[model samples]
Target: MTRPRLLPVPLAPLPNELIGSYLNRLADANRLPIRRIDALIATGRHHSRDKDDLTGWTLSSIERLAALTGRNSPALIHALPSLAALAQPNPLPTPPASLTPTAWKTKVCQLCAASRGVHGLAVQRTYPHQRICLQHQRWLGGRQLPISPRFHELIRANIRHRRLLRGHRDPLQPSALHDEARTMTSRWFSNNNGPLELQRTWDDRLQMLNPDTESDPHDDRNLIEMVTYPETVVLTTLLSKPHNPVHHDFLAEVIRSFGLDPRSLPALHRHTTLPSSMRNPDTPSHPSRHRPGSKSTA
Candidate 1:
């Protein structure tokens, strides 16, 4: 049987975009209902109650979607990470286990979506470490907080994060380091026990990111995460290296590099060991505490 003609307008998929999101954009572009687009690509009986569910697509359906969207299968697979699994002969089972299931998906930066001609909500699967949109200087994991490009440390941290993900031999090490760093930083931020200079730095960032008010009720936690991100990344990088000793002097020097007093951290003052996660590389890291809309502080 001959397939239906391709849509007149072609929409490009954003990197790491969900296949379902692409279909919705495709439907919106052609003024078709999402179900109609789904029907066009559906190869057999659909099992998902939600039409846009990721599990709905198969290799055959991806081919049909390629035909309808005027894109090749490889291109579709490349643009949508989930499609690569569906293209496999024996795909992994559904409901992939995650410590934080809701965090597996995140909103894409609106500016980035608009650049691709998408002006609506665009969600993509994301790893825990994927937080900032270095391209647009916006926070991807939470309510939109536009950061200034002048924050060289934050930008450099984002770059290092990308490199860590790409270059690390052990896939789990980067995430472990990031999680531990975030935990430690969050503890300090919440306790309000960091050095006076460090506290002022965070306050400065909070003010800059939320200039309209003394504080933003909606963005406080996210702001805290953003303010601490550079330090978090720096600590992560230091711990990721095997040669970097986790001693008081080493920690003190790192604090001094940020132009903050090291003695302010009680851990440093007492010369206690760093968190076990930092000391032992094999320690299982906890899930990130910075999930969107989470009321849990730190």
Candidate 2:
């Protein structure tokens, strides 16, 4: 059968949409086999940027896609902000093996995938700094799925850190922060002990978000990710300077942004345990002076 003059679908720039996704959807709507259409497109001799199985389309490929979709190339490119960097081909040089770094890679948002009828994990969705989808107001739940609520504060902290980087105040990238934050959180949680009520409060909050049977709400991995993610993000911000304020009022502002309380959480134990030399006796560290009787979210 002959290919139709052009696909009729419009390119929707849903958050972090992948080029592979757009192509497959286009193929599905056109009632043509993906491999066949892909092969035909390959014949156009366009530039290629392949990521494993998915090809990160270049400007030339976008033009080909535009011709097939009956859309303007410039308009299509404008819609995909993520691809703007690729418009010009100044690829980075690979670092030597000794200098290569690695950490937990980014993953896609489940809600974003399901909306497009994508299954078994959609596109990579690998923006490490983006743990919570502020747009959709959901947690990224590790694998391509949305877990539940009760993480808005953590999400807010994540957004604030990103804004800091955007404003050029912080020199470290999200990946570096990711590594340090985990280290700090792990050490703090393992070394310090807090009130039992505080521990229970955290556990109960996580339980409310966990899925039913089969997967334990108290699973070690889930707890670690949920706890460390926000802690590290907040810590990264505080650690920006050699010394961070240990005073309850300032600490409260930081924790409040994470939807947490300074008085009850174990994660904040480090600030409490600092040497008296580090603490200011004049500034008390307990129920926040900013707002008395504010309940802890976790």
Candidate 3:
């Protein structure tokens, strides 16, 4: 006896969607339990605990899914970023030891998903640089914020961050730079005695994002990160360049551009270090070579 061909469903997978999510959507569309659909498509033991799990999936399983969905394997691969890794003979490359994965995994923007006929929740394996949906102007991985002019700066910063990521050969370099920038920005934001102008700017942003009388903006780390993103991008760019003494005027100008007093430079200098590539090679032994805060002594 031979197995029969499965009927194709009308629903299609969204970009970067998990294979499990697509299967669930298919089951929902056809009014069948996901287990039935899984039994039909997945030859290996299915794990239901983690929705993102593709542990036992082979190339044949992906091909089965593609056939069941009336789509080609390439189409499925294009839609599911992790499918290629699963289909390949080799395991996925391990991320750099220095880089830790974020605890948060973002869902596809509700509006973006609905636009593609995907009404069910669809989780995505997003990169560190991917925080906002530029097309829909929605923040991912957290409660959605209302569209406002205040978020425009964040959107612009994200654009620059993406561009930076593209130009770098080692993604870890950009990731490290972003991490450092986030640390500086977060620290400065938490400093009550920091520049009053900068503090007021962030406070206004907090109010804009959280208008409810009882909502404490300080409690929402996502909101704080979003509001501080512009400065972070700017600082990342500054730190990537060589620490030129002649750049102090330019640095102060950039600080002033953020509505911060140039004298507040120490707040940015406090804990930040210059990247090795950005350090002065002639004065390798100089204390300021490692720490940007010691520039005055240099």
Per-model CA lDDT versus the true structure: 0.66, 0.51, 0.68
Per residue, candidate 3 scores C-alpha lDDT tens digits across 163-200 of 88788777566766677667767876876644667678
**Over 4 Å off, model 1:** 1-4, 43-53, 90-104, 126-130, 163-167, 170-172, 214-219, 243-262, 265-298
Candidate 1 TM-score versus the reference: 0.71
Which pairs of residues have clashing backbones in candidate 1? none
Where does candidate 1 have its weakest 10-residue lDDT segment? 283-292
> Which residue runs does candidate 2 get wrong by more than 4 Å?
1-4, 13-15, 43-59, 74-86, 91-126, 143-152, 169-175, 183-202, 211-214, 218-223, 242-298
Ranking by lDDT: 3, 1, 2
Give the winner by TM-score: 3
Worst-scoring 10-residue span by lDDT in model 3: 283-292
Highest lDDT scorer: 3
* Clashing residue pair totals per candidate (backbone < 3 A): 0, 3, 0
What's the residue-level lDDT of 287 in candidate 2? 25
Winner on TM-score between 2 and 3 is 3
lDDT tens digits, residue span 1-298, model 2 = 2333565554343344455555555666667666645655553322211122324445555566666777775666565444556664785675433222232334456666667665433343334466666667665645433435556666666787677557544333444545555564555445444334435555665666654667765455546566556666665565443443443344445556556555654445433433222245543433233123444465
Question: Tens digit of lDDT per residue, candidate 1, span 163-247?
Answer: 8768878645666667766777777677765566766777787776677775573347777888889888877776676643323
Give the total clashing residue pairs for model 2: 3
Candidate 2 pairs with clashing backbones = 106-126, 107-125, 153-258
Clashes of 1: 0
